[model samples]
Target: MHSSPRIRTSVAATVLALAVVAPTAAMAMPTAPKAPVEAKKSTQNYKGLPSGVSKKKTLVIGLDGAAAAQINEKNTPNLAALVKNGMLAKSNLYANPMAPTVSGAGWSTIATGVWPDKHKVPDNSFANPNYAQYPDYLTRLEIARAQSSTLVVGTWSPIPQKVFGEKTDLRLAGGNDAGTTAKTVDYLKNGNPDSTFVHLDEIDGAGHSSGSSSAAYAKAHATADAQIGQILAAVDERKAKKSEDWMVVITADHGHTPGGGHGGSSTGERATFVIAQGKGIEAGSVRHDVKISDIAPTVLKHQGVRIEDEWQLDGQAAGTIKADDFDSLRPHLKTGVDETKPGTTTTGWTTTAPSGWSIDNSAMPAGGVTEWQGWSFATDEFWTNVDLNQGRETSVHNRNVFAVADSDEWDDKAHAAGQFDSTLISPSYKVRGGKTATLSFASNYRIDGPQSGEVFVSFDGGEPRLLKSYDKNFNGVETISIDVPKKAKKAKVSFRYTGTNSAFWTVDQVSLKK
Candidate 1:
């Protein structure tokens, strides 16, 4: 019997996937963050606007789960416009392979200019509840303020609220309408201090849960773009009233996998954007090889504050511009799944309530709705498995046992039921902006029993639009156009199953073309 595939859990499965990476020897990563740049206290105890007719101001805007696949030029006109006008830094890092690559770790890296290991805030919940320094979601504001007069606004996380203190300017709201964009405006307008930051998380949330190509994903991009537009407008509004030197920095904590995950090993996670405008940013700038942690120091430099080199950060001021023109493109690196190791496959559909498991074609397992949405089982004794490369994760039902292997090839014993189960595998993919594309592939659903499967497409990885579903049609495996809209950054297709009972299916070698 053919062996089953390797199943994994969502980073979120880690309860704070953002903070954990599968532990490994600490790589001799990058540099450390310097001490917080100190602002020269106002000499006069005067209340109100003073200074040589206003000094330049610095601002930092962070987007969680923001990346090329999640939001691109075509879908996000405002952000795209910002890129066009400012410096665009396409490649950057937030965490190491050891880091879970989850939100907290990723954002913290951007915030403290340090890694998970250095910051000691690895996952969502760390050892012994310590509400001491830098807070987490659900904490109070005063907790985060004892050190600095920081202002933080967040959507799903309470860390910002805790870090900023009770008097801290922190707000929690919906992802859309007055989202991260609005919080930023308030910070810039009121708490316009030497250091200020606003976090946007919709992009990543939509992309990670929904495929990057789903309509939900598209909506997220559009919403974020609209909010970004407002942010730009706010900046401009301030500019109209009086010259406020504001340098806007935008970048993602980390990218996600085609399967809507980042914790797993994939080239996508290492991919993020670093676009900046105004003040020391230099217009029409384009830099490469910038990491998330580097933004802090870059902001410090722009404000003309000297930072102590004690923090030990990993990023450097990057790029070259029309005003920039200083940096170069970041290294193009893409890591593929280790095929030689235990892998997932949709070789057949489980039927007759196959004691093993059954899942949908979208790559979800058939067994027990993936407790917390995991990819594979911890053990293989009783679970039927399906695996694939970067798309919606395949699922398994009846598969309950769990086991850990150092490699990809799984060696476990499993029995089959008398009847056939039903299932289909669907995975998400990505495409560049302004392109008409095709997703072509070859798949086989072992069970011929009253079943129909097709490859469906979604805009930003939202819903599936039937590209072609079949009971037993393998279209010679040539190539087909996916017909993506003008504005598509992510694309996804799945072998949809319209059959009774749950079963497994097999699909391979899928690609997208313009």
Candidate 2:
């Protein structure tokens, strides 16, 4: 995760700098930041393993805080080999923006094949975690087959307790990376567990101690490569002796900042990669992007474990890679809003000129700015002011680009009075043979007071019918389901933003599915 080891600077910078910087006697605090509200942890217990077994074995290697950018043949030869022989070498799989890019949440996403909504791990502390309800894949495997052997080895002690859970039969949680590697190799050679998970923390430690771009980080990665090479050697020997098929998957929980901190949504922090090498995986078959949740299902599928719908898994098997299929409401419509500059044509979708929607890249009133190189707009808020020297960027919705309808001109005033209305309509969709449809999009809105705005749907040149109404403070993604009336064969959607006094509405990634 991004925010850690609070490094305070006495000199001033911006709102974010103040947010993270420890207070000093010489400085007058800009504003006492509100403490983050954590979600309540659940205490539900799950059932034991049902009787079943898969033919193939599985191994998962998790590298904490490893940035894809830092990976190279010269620095990490063993990892390079795995990538060269696996599906991930040519693919671009990103960790979904489910929660902050932190170890506990990212690893939970990897282990459970679900987002934070299901696992409920928001940070590293594992505070109020709901892992009992959403157990790890190892635990799921145990549930499927009570007699199956499972092993977990990690230098990070919390990973075994917080991520792998209680199902594993052999857990070597504490020790240095080398010691952990020795244990994993020994277990691979002798214990022969059906499913295994290996966690390495030194690379991340190096990133935090030395910058991610530094030589020290590179050396740490190299040392880890040597250790992994030894473990792989054991796996090869086991495969040769037993003639057993195995699937090996490798991935990282999150990426580190250049300065070695994480827990934010910056591109660097969100950077993650996955590699699948073994039975049924395509060699040199590259995928453009994959989610971390996909790893669990992919591994299970390879192990011959049946993934049922009742499990409510968010991932699919890695065997088949397909283009966008409009099974969900979002795949039908082109992107009406994306991370693009104001006045520029959005990449996938189009809108009418009369539409009041425009992108806003300037610093928000909350003191967040999109620090893209092309962001030339001047920010005027006192707390929002910050130098671009450290290359830190902030966004209102954790992104640089967003569609906005603001009440005042960019540089004019603090707030505006009276109504400021805007509508962003979608390109027409021919949903002739489709059933009920759903619309989803991410948005952040602010008003002087009270709720204001509505989402509407129109059927084939008919009047717009209300879909959903905005009545309170909302700052995240919203999905609305609409049943297509029998009379309509085609439909169009629009978000009507209406507000009085000071207000602004920002939207992105609008999609529809039937």
Q: Which candidate number would show the highest TM-score if scored against the true structure? A: 2
Model 2 bad stretches (over 4 Å): 1-53, 89-101, 240-245, 264-267, 279-288, 306-453, 472-481, 496-514
> Which residue segments of model 1 deviate by more than 4 Å?
1-54, 70-73, 92-97, 126-150, 162-179, 186-194, 239-242, 280-282, 319-514
TM-score, per-candidate, Cα-based: 0.48, 0.65
After TM-score superposition, the amount by which residue 275's alpha carbon in candidate 2 deviates from its true location, in angstroms, is: 2.7
Write one digit per residue (lDDT tens) for candidate 2, span 78-114: 8887777877722112233335667788888889887
lDDT of each: 0.44, 0.58
For every model shown, the clashing-pair count is 106, 13
168, model 2: CA deviation in Å?
2.5
Q: For candidate 1, lDDT tens digit of each residue in 242-278?
A: 6456677777776666667565434456556777777
Q: In model 1, how large is the Cα lDDT of residue 56?
A: 49
